[model samples]
Target: MAHHRTFDLLSRLPKVDLHLHLDGSVKPETLLELALHQGIDLPVYDREGLIPHMRVGEECGSLIEYLSKFHFTTRIMQSGEALERIAYEVVQQSAEHNCKYVEVRFAPQLHRNNGLTVEETIHHVVEGMKRGQRDFGVRGGVIAICMRNHSCQSNLEVIEAAAQFVGKGVVAVDLAGDEAAYPPEFFREVFAESTRLGIPVTIHAGEAAGAVNVYEAVTNLGAVRIGHGVRLKENRSILEMVKERRIPLEMCPISNIQTKAVSSWEAYPIREYLEQGLLVTINTDNPSVSGTDITNEYRVLSDRFGFTAPELVKLIMNGVDAAFLDEADKLLLRREMENEISSLGVSL
Candidate 1:
């Protein structure tokens, strides 16, 4: 234990991130390039100047405020070329940080503010991700997202578009944004359509809303996974349901604090959830926006929760289990991580 630097070991370990946001994952340099190519005027051109606009700090009061940061990045992603390039960069960055698998989520309607159709938007992302896997050996796909704030009819269209790409490069469908104002109750028909289309469902619930939203997501929306289920802890019955059903919770500690999902790091429920038998996976909700990555997440969490080698392996495996990969692929990924960790000389 003394011989190994925990960060080094964690960095080399294979990882999975199921909650990352494609719109929020744009590289600062890439943002500048897209802005330049599109003639979009930004307040800053350099990385130092551009990064602050992309990220939120303690001043970020609520989920909606934190979401305001995406205006810069998402505005730049209107073109298919820009989306493809950003997708490629996401894979390259994930691979560089040793992520074996990842699922980048984005609302297709965001890109459609320009002339791009939803299908075209997904096609470009798929092509970019395919190219990344071809060159970088990191395999992953996209989760098409339905924004909660949209009209119900519009959300149904988004899910319909997502359903078309289910086997192509898209893995699942997720509901994101302003969950407090737009509860899962209103989106039942939208996700019901997803389940009917054979697309797996994950919802952003109990995030800006209460545990009741989490309950509605599970019972009404047919959500197989809950994104940022922090507030679920507020309701014992709902918490027990999540634990009893073994629904994976995508817990992002950094973004949770930045969005005030929890009051502080000490208040975050990762350790408590794990101890209480809730299946939990650590993820970077947005790498660029949160200014963190998979390795950095594992390390910071280790510092706060006192996670050792075996516990760290549990965290990584939790990600593998919760990943959208098929069973055989999950087995292969598990073996790859185990072999890599073993070769790194860290006993797990």
Candidate 2:
């Protein structure tokens, strides 16, 4: 396909993003503005410093260093008002990128440094999402994230807060943050509780860790989706299980390359996972942090992995199917996305 044609087609294709972090999506300009307003000093305040950190370059040598960039963004988002504004901006940015629906995840515990209770943190983000939906006509849901390194009790508390907001825009629970330090087995009870409440669960596994993390997430934590599950390719048994179970892997190629999860886009296991019949969906895990969007991700896949228009469409459908929303909403969004793709004259 011609590059411009592919770009145009991808831009017009209605899509759903299943994996995106709220704090990680803060735009550099927005971060600078927020920092100035709050009088917070950051090393990378100028465009020169900010641009390098935003892109998937030498700055992100490892997942830990990649995450350190968020410290600058999250430092300014200490209040409920800041969280709400950033959430609204996240949804608005998604809509601008032609996303029809998005599941935005965030670790609320990280926001409590300003003495804001967990409930209050959820309230701020949920309110922002609601406002964005009402204003931009893009449907969204919040996934409450529990950091892995935290104690099991802390994870349970986050899950309890998520349970409280079940029908109120908080649709799911997730395990994230520093995969190497904490394993998925540590949060078995939390995942069980989330499953018992009928809330969907996903875990950040196989990104910085090994395939064992992915296996534990599925068998031990009951994860329906695996975040950055590129490592699952190393273990055939786990790969087979993921394929048989039809678990979705939210593959963020740019973020993976930036965080050293994989060497390059061509080396990414997204094609391997797709060929093995594991439901794989493309996403920009953190657009601002990775200096990418859905369009850029699609372009990278198409260019490096030789994904055709139909293949990209299938990826979008996979995301819609794997979303945490209700069946009725999924059916509705699927139909709408298909219609949009059809309008682009792309054969699927």
Candidate 3:
């Protein structure tokens, strides 16, 4: 039998987070400060009082209710200064938790309500990620997300604007929002442009919907990775299609459970997927909103699923393989993770 490790050891290990959301991950104190700076009226003025409004947990009713937290967060992320600060702090926090790499994602369209263009919005996030990397030594990238509820024309404009910074700062594009309502077929033209530009693709599916959505995201939208694909097990054929394609599934344990994406903790399916030889990578979907960090995510697996050191390391490697980076960077990151573990006097 495999023995679980302590939280301290888990915290020290190098980590990779690929599905993190920028708006939902902002610090409560920072959100309050931004609210005050912008003179935006928040329901609460203090961080403590504001947390209940911004953060959520397992008791949250459904994915829709959990997503409601972003309504307040987007209000504060309207300005370039606020966006830069939030993006920088995301990587800074990643370093504090020993995350070697992360991909911070957000809908550029959501930040444009304050009169900024989509290009300007992406620029601020890229600038912040650059500064964070220079200072914290954490390598990361920005992902531009298009909302499902938005018009196809509107989403196309966002995708075209983001393509300008693909390699410069933005690494990939993603789809988010009410998956059940919009479905993957709705974004065909929007993601078609992404494919034409040779940009990597990932989509939010199988969380609030069924496995068919995941199938469409892959078969239609060219999603190289599926975010919160926790519900893909609903269809064996579609699940096998994912496996046969070698497409990785980005799983966020805390967020999935909190959103009721699964029936219960036992049905989360991380172990089940692993047993079947599917590629699974752990991520922090929305740290502050979910009230979780990458460390706590691993702790949950350790406590509930008995993921030993080797199993944990396998997940890390899976993240590396699934990253949007080129082969050279991915190889280098894998080596650094291994060397760092050795230096800590721990063997994988």
Query: TM-score for every candidate vs. truth?
Result: 0.97, 0.95, 0.97
In Å, residue 133's CA in model 3 sits off its true spot by 0.4
Worst 10 residues of 3 by lDDT: 1-10
Ranking by lDDT: 3, 1, 2
**Alpha-carbon error at 1 in model 3, in Å?**
18
**Candidate 3, which segments miss by more than 4 Å at Cα?**
1-5
- If both were scored by lDDT, which would come out higher, candidate 1 or candidate 2? 1
lDDT of each: 0.88, 0.86, 0.91
In candidate 3, residue 276 scores what lDDT? Answer: 87
> Clash number for model 3?
0
Alpha carbon deviation, residue 311, candidate 1 (Å): 0.7
Q: How would you encode candidate 1's per-residue C-alpha lDDT over 256-297 as one tens digit per residue?
A: 888888888888888888889898998999998888988889
Error of 2 at 100 (Å): 0.3
Per-residue error for 135 in candidate 2, Å, reads 1.5
User: Which of the numbered candidates is closest to the native, going by highest lDDT?
Assistant: 3
The list of candidate 1 runs beyond 4 A from truth reads 1-4
